[model samples]
Target: MKFGRRQFIGTTVGAAAALSAPAVLGQARPRVVVIGGGAGGATAARYVAKDSKGAIDVTLIEPTRRYYTCFFSNLYIGGFHEMAALGHGYGKLASDYGVNVLHDYAIGVDRGAKTVALAGGGSVPYDRLILSPGIDFKEGSVPGWDLTSQNAMPHAYKGGTQAELLKAQVEAMPEGGVFCMVAPPNPYRCPPGPYERVSMVAHVLKARNPTAKILIVDPKPKFSKQALFEEGWQDHYAGMVDRIGPDFGGDVVEVRPDSMEVVIDGTVEKVDVCNVIPAMKAGHIAALAGVTDEAGWAPVVPASMQSRMDENIHVLGDAAQQGDMPKSGFAANSQAKVCAMAVRAALTGSKVFPAKFSNTCWSLIETDDGVKVGATYKPTEEKIAKVDGFISQTGEAAGLRKRTYEESIGWYAGITADMFG
Candidate 1:
């Protein structure tokens, strides 16, 4: 069957009959198909599968055999953490949690039929659908920046091939070579990520090439955890890192990968290594489904994370337009739990429970020291609001910094356990 936009909505009557016929009266359980088994989708699949205890069949569709979290990826480049530590397989979700993990990309959602079509040629029908496909780069947002140029100037935001590429480039740089990082504008993934990356890279460069430099080209004047990151850079690297914010005429508009140079509004600067984080939008799936708004983010009801345009589908994680919540792994994981509970309540005709969300992101400045920002939140009427949290305090004692670094590792272990193990 050709599953076009018209066909999807036109066959709902027949689809509803097929879904409600013998299956409703049979011994089988309600099925939930989740697209993208990353931070959000994997957590939702595991929770729904475990909570329902065979009363809910959870199927997760992801293109990759494994997932590498963007969190703690900077440590890999700094030579402080291994890539294996940042990687996770989906075996636990499948075997222990009883989730059906499909290693294929979701091409489209047949919302009217409550089914998800796979790029590998098949569709999985569901009683409910949860989508968290993450962000996709907006093409032509930056002149001369696209897929082909990405290979040369890696955007390590995705945390896989790009991470490896960035690490290799950093390690191969000559003594005292300049490493240029082009930070994206506001409302990008991991708001503090590019800055943290510069800190970690500076740490490595200082150890290997004492005179090496890090030049950051930012579009914004300030960033998340700006004070703490700046203090850490000064205390640790000692002027090895230099930041050029928008006020300082550092807005990048073009890139020339052929010469390993970046142009900030006509001024060209050559560098030994270049890491460009491009503008991003909701994943292609969200846009194709017509759930994303003009801002290129999926709009959903805060209480349930259900799409305002389509009740059968819910969007979460980076694809969602949840205000006051930064797009981090912790935020995605928390949102997934809320989305999971909402899906369960809707499928069983039960009342939805109140959601308490949490997010914490840690950026390692050095091997023994790290900085973090976190908050706990809840839905208030139409938006998510933070209840309480803290950012790492600057000039903290050595012992406190050490403790924070240890706490970050613990948090990572705990969240990963909750999501997959």
Candidate 2:
């Protein structure tokens, strides 16, 4: 479905909801500076510029020249998608929406001055700031693993090159090789992402090296769509996959990147490839802005997506600690629209409608085999609460699964277009 403004769910948080106060315009046109042009930032920039009809100035700052969608990155590892296909550019947002797209890093956020400092030694002042920067790894969350050890044991958590490196590493493993993955704890980006990656890796090994083993050492006792993934794994790659949940010392684990060893409860096992997904926090920019809480996520108002710390700034995507919403691309994109509307209302004295949000996360277990979990959310007094939800049932027909997979393909096209355009 097209995700502009939807009917806000309940009468609980009604149309009476509004921002604390509209920004006092520093310029004739209210300027909105968006940091990290992924799903959240890009969509927010586009929506604010488009909806305002040139009334608001939107500038998007993202260091990458090309952006990759982490949602479908696992398919690339499974040989179902090409790297080029996963990449997108901001040319359309610039040319079509008149957004000033800057390919520079945001080094600091001066909340007092309402300006963002760029790595290029320039700063851009904003009437309202939108931060959609994604997740960052918690330092030393995975024992003996850090960014320096990333090459030896790749954590393909972020969107781009790490996925490439991980796929390459998986392909290079010898016959009957062991591919080990240390899955992240809860509240990470994409709850099902690591499991989907595991499924994709299993898909590759099943095709190339039939005897190869796939091992997952996960800290969590159970994961998103656990029943569905387990059912799919059993149906397709029966004996090829093995997961060690928290009960089996999956929580107490360490990795020695130099030796390619995974120490599970002090039992070291040398593996051919290790995909280490460490615990994560909000993107560093959120912390720099002093918007993030002790848990390392920027909490926001459900109605406006404005930061709890600073109302002039809004947090979107994986960075925001809005309740009941998983830190996924779809969730971020959904949150951004609400934010965009609120920002516009605050800036231009436009109508602020009640906010409705929704998200659906699709995962591919095998070719033509897909499953999803999703829900619609409404703003309540305390948090963005789940209104209703649905999931793909176990033992679903082949045709349905195929249709679900195809639906994801269409969603990819629709969402990317929605974000960039």
The numbered model that scores best in lDDT is 2
lDDT by residue (1-421, candidate 2, tens digit) is 3222122222212332443333455657789999999989998898888778788889999999999988799999999999999999999999999999999999999999999999999899999999999999999899999999999999988888999999999999999999999999988999999989989999999889999999999999999999999999999999999999889999999999999999999899899999999999999999999999998999999899999999999999899999998898888878888888898888888788878888889999999999999999999877999999999999999999988888788778767877887
Q: Which lDDT value does model 1 have at 323?
A: 70
Write one digit per residue (lDDT tens) for candidate 1, span 285-401.
Answer: 998777999989998887778888898898989999877888888788788878877787767543455676777778888777877888878887777888888888888888877
Residue 360 in candidate 1, Cα distance off native in Å: 1.3
Q: Give me candidate 1's TM-score against the actual structure.
A: 0.92
Top candidate when judged by TM-score against the true structure: 2
Off-target runs (Cα >4 Å) in candidate 2 are 1-27
Clashing residue pairs in all predictions, respectively, total 0, 0
**RMSD (CA, angstroms), candidate 1:** 8.7
lDDT of each: 0.80, 0.89
Q: In model 1, how large is the Cα lDDT of residue 124?
A: 94
